[model samples]
Target: QKEVEQDPGPLSVPEGAIVSLNCTYSNSAFQYFMWYRQYSRKGPELLMYTYSSGNKEDGRFTAQVDKSSKYISLFIRDSQPSDSATYLCAMSEASWGKLQFGAGTQVVVTP
Candidate 1:
């Protein structure tokens, strides 16, 4: 188990909405954020990445990066059942640095 607790999930959401997903860690040295979504047996696909601190948005997805708080978040808007997957959070010292994973969160977007 990790101190990384994802809220409103291992989650279930209706086809088009959900609260933000959060992740917290103890490593203050981490400087990069990576979010990935993996389907039942498929390889994980990278969703987004953020540097030290700030928010980044791509389409309906938003990533909030706060290094000072040792926190990061991924928000999915207008979710679809296809959004249902095992989501993974990773942190690194640099963009290509060694990756450390969070405990992982699974989300279900219901139809």
Candidate 2:
């Protein structure tokens, strides 16, 4: 299996829907969990970062990590067309920097 796996989704939903994106990783050595949002042709922007397992929330986004299951998730609340983008899950050993990423999930929020 690949080190990380995520459905490269073109998951389409109407405005105001809640969106959930997830990934699974095979490496237990990964110490940092992260989510990134990327627009077409743009570098990803960091969405969230968590160490080990637990939950972290910010504005419209929430990130969850389950180390026992080797899984992680990102939830978007009150989704909007402006939120259309690719969501990427990443993990790394260093808390200060760099990440290994999933292929990314593409999302479209329509009016």
Best by lDDT: 2
State the TM-score for model 2.
0.95
Q: Please provide TM-scores, in order, for all candidate models, with all chains considered together.
A: 0.89, 0.95
* Candidate 2 lDDT tens digits, 5-62: 9999899999999999999999888889989999999999999989999999999999
lDDT of 2: 0.93
Whole-model lDDT per candidate: 0.83, 0.93
Candidate 1, residues 1-111: lDDT per residue as tens digits? 564445425788889896477788887888888898888889989999888899999998999998888889999999998899988888888777788887668898889
How high is the lDDT of residue 34 in model 1? 87
Q: What is the lDDT of candidate 1?
A: 0.83
Off by over 4 Å in 1: 1-9
Question: For model 2, what is the error of residue 104's alpha carbon versus the real structure, in angstroms, after optimal superposition?
Answer: 0.3
Error of 2 at 16 (Å): 0.4
The TM-score between candidate 1 and the true structure equals 0.89
